[model samples]
Target: MTKAQIGLIGLGTMGSNLALNIAEKGHAVAVYNRTASKTGAFFENAADLRERIVPCATLAEFVAQIRPPRPVVLMVQAGKAVDEQIAALREHLEAGDMIIDAGNANFRDTIRRFGELEGSGLTFVGMGVSGGEEGARHGPSIMVGGAQEAWRQIEPILTDIAARFQGEPCAAWLGEGGAGHFVKTIHNGIEYADMQMIAEIYGLLRDGAGLSAGEMATIFQRWNSGPLESYLVEITAEVLRASDGATGGPLVDAILDRAGQKGTGRWAAVEAQLMGIPATTIETAVAARSLSAERDLRLKAQGAYADALPTGRLVADEAFIRDLEHALLAAKLAAYAQGFAVMEEASTEFRWDLPLGTVARIWRAGCIIRSQFLSEIAAAYDQAREPAHLLLMPAFVDTMTMASPALRRVVARGVEAGLPVPALAAALTWFDAFRQGRGTANLIQGQRDFFGAHGFERVDAQGDHHGAWSK
Candidate 1:
């Protein structure tokens, strides 16, 4: 195995943490940042924080400091800045080297960059690293896209710094060309849906069960040990239970109700729609957040609807738990459905050899959207060449049957309490639509044929039962 000498750029929160992580693992890493003070500060901090690290003042110097066929990681802001930084560094780099964009880059740009860099011996990997700043400090889920040969050379150091999932690193050659960023974009989309689901559960507790944040946190903590256990759920409880310092109000109330989103979530939703994949939960979550931002509109409606609202008893814990569990499960199902849908669409579109089973296995740890159910998802993917049949598996169907009782009631309460329950609804809708509504007219096929001049099959094609619509 070849020991890799890595170079990193952008020493902000993410970059600095990554540099520190690399150094802590005992790799010879040289980092460069445009800002002189940060570069000086990082070296001094690294020596104090942990020794055995190197820093470079300029991109050229950083390139010269490391050996040839160098692996330089650009952890700058996505979009043009990534290009500018890479362009500057190119002055010192030569053919046969590698440049990695570790930002939330647009996938199309990833492909364009790959095309531009081709024929030069240099390799380009549009890499997506997830787990946020915390993930950078410990280990992050890495989605690598580019030449497979480049991946082979870089895997050693990447594996060392990546999160462990099922005894393997949370890093994979996601697919060809732009697949890394594509995967990362979808990863973020899934992240948006996951968070919205968590937020809905809190609303259910507050509105339906009349529980405080502390109480909701306890329920989340309780769910952590079961099949529903996950990193997000664990964090959900902690964040909810937290309190504001001065006002001493519930921390949930103290924080902004309006969720923040980068363009990645929108990208996933748009791509999903283009691929004709039903990203209902993901879509709904995005819409819900956008709507939430109109706080003034909500205030106006508050007075309008207060008088018309019906009086209802707040359900006790035992009863509320039944419905809450169902809502959570349903939302979880929807979230996973959107994630898999995006994955399927991207795999087909990009023609990348994405292993669905492997993908699920890699998501089992370190990633923001990891879940306890990923192991089962991996098994299902392994059982079938296609992951679309996942919901049909008898074992999984049975597991869902066991889980559904709780989710059904939870969803009901969520709906009744006026909670934003897109995740729950999305999950249930997919399951119901899949199980109960197969062979039904989708209108999608007909619409596609009409606009794109594609053909649609009649309900009874050979029986001459065609509809009377003119082309």
Candidate 2:
């Protein structure tokens, strides 16, 4: 029997890291990059990699190194580079060979690529690799897509290089077509909202409580012991505590408020709306980023329309804090509900059995966006139904009842101090929507404008079809 081999297409940060991991697992690796020297040096530097690294001069030779039915992973840039790599290697790869695009590709492209490659007997897979450079260099979360037959050929190697989520390896066969990239895309989307929520909470502590940077960090440190503990929130406090270079004050204030994103968040939210799932919180968070970019304009708008901020207080005690933590958990559950709702809709819409529980487990480690909350989400998927409310479930409802008041108090404090808290707002909105018997929005009108351009229900079904009053 021959040693299984993996061919890595690029040698940049992500690619290099992936190569290191693949080779580290004691498998034969055929490394290739457009720039020959860097690829040569990368493999040359590794004392153990000397035997594994078969540096090929050309794409044909690169494809030739794998014993038979080669599995080559292209971790190059998105867009044209993906097509370029495929074009260069098409003639070289044999019929049974497998091609994995580990790049952050648009999901639609993956779907199209699947069609192009399937007829030729060459398998195409779009895998989403999370856990940046370090994760790749060691172990990372790997989401795989395309045919099940293609996945079986490389599952061993993927398992070797993937991180552990819960007890299982952080790798899963996500299904055919663009399923892998779709999962990864929605993963990033949920990540966007999660980070925004933490940021909103941090901002609230700063502006609302009139607390200094160090003071806010203390609160986070305290929260870490409870349900609110998370990698991002932990980092938030560390960043807040760091000193500025010039003023020696907190470094956070010096950083720009305008955040940059890769567009997945907005894409997820938009797709959610199209699929008729609720994603208002995530959408609003994206909008909040846009609003932050226009801080000056927003300030001017505030001048045009003035209003008083709201306020609330929670009595300080261990019991209250515990209750607040429960609320935080509940809110987080709601946040995830919106995100999963999007994924669930996409999975059904696209005809893939995405293994929702497995996704939740894979997100528990190595990925940039993993949290303890994902553990709960995995169980939720095990029992969830279409359009089901996670928060309304018995377990979640009990948790919410215990903590919603305290969470609301904390949010009230933010409102009083004029701090931004979109995460909490999204959570609250989801909560109210779930708990309330009647939704006030002209749902019919919403359906018409976005779906069919129909009229809105003004008050009730009996009242009237609301059009802008001709006044």
Each prediction's TM-score versus the true structure: 0.91, 0.85
* Candidate 1 residue pairs in backbone clash: 96-121, 323-409, 323-410, 324-410, 326-406, 326-407, 331-423, 331-424
**What's model 2's lDDT at 445?**
62
lDDT of 1 by residue, 3-65 (tens): 338888999999999988887877888888899899998888776544446677767678887
Alpha-carbon runs more than 4 Å astray in model 2: 1-4, 44-50, 243-250, 294-327, 383-387, 441-471
How many clashing residue pairs appear in each of the predictions shown? 8, 3
- Give candidate 1's root-mean-square deviation (CA, Å): 3.2
Candidate 1 runs further than 4 Å off:
1-4, 48-51, 385-387, 438-456, 463-471
Best by lDDT: 1
lDDT tens string, model 2, 192-232? 77777777666654554456788778777778766776766
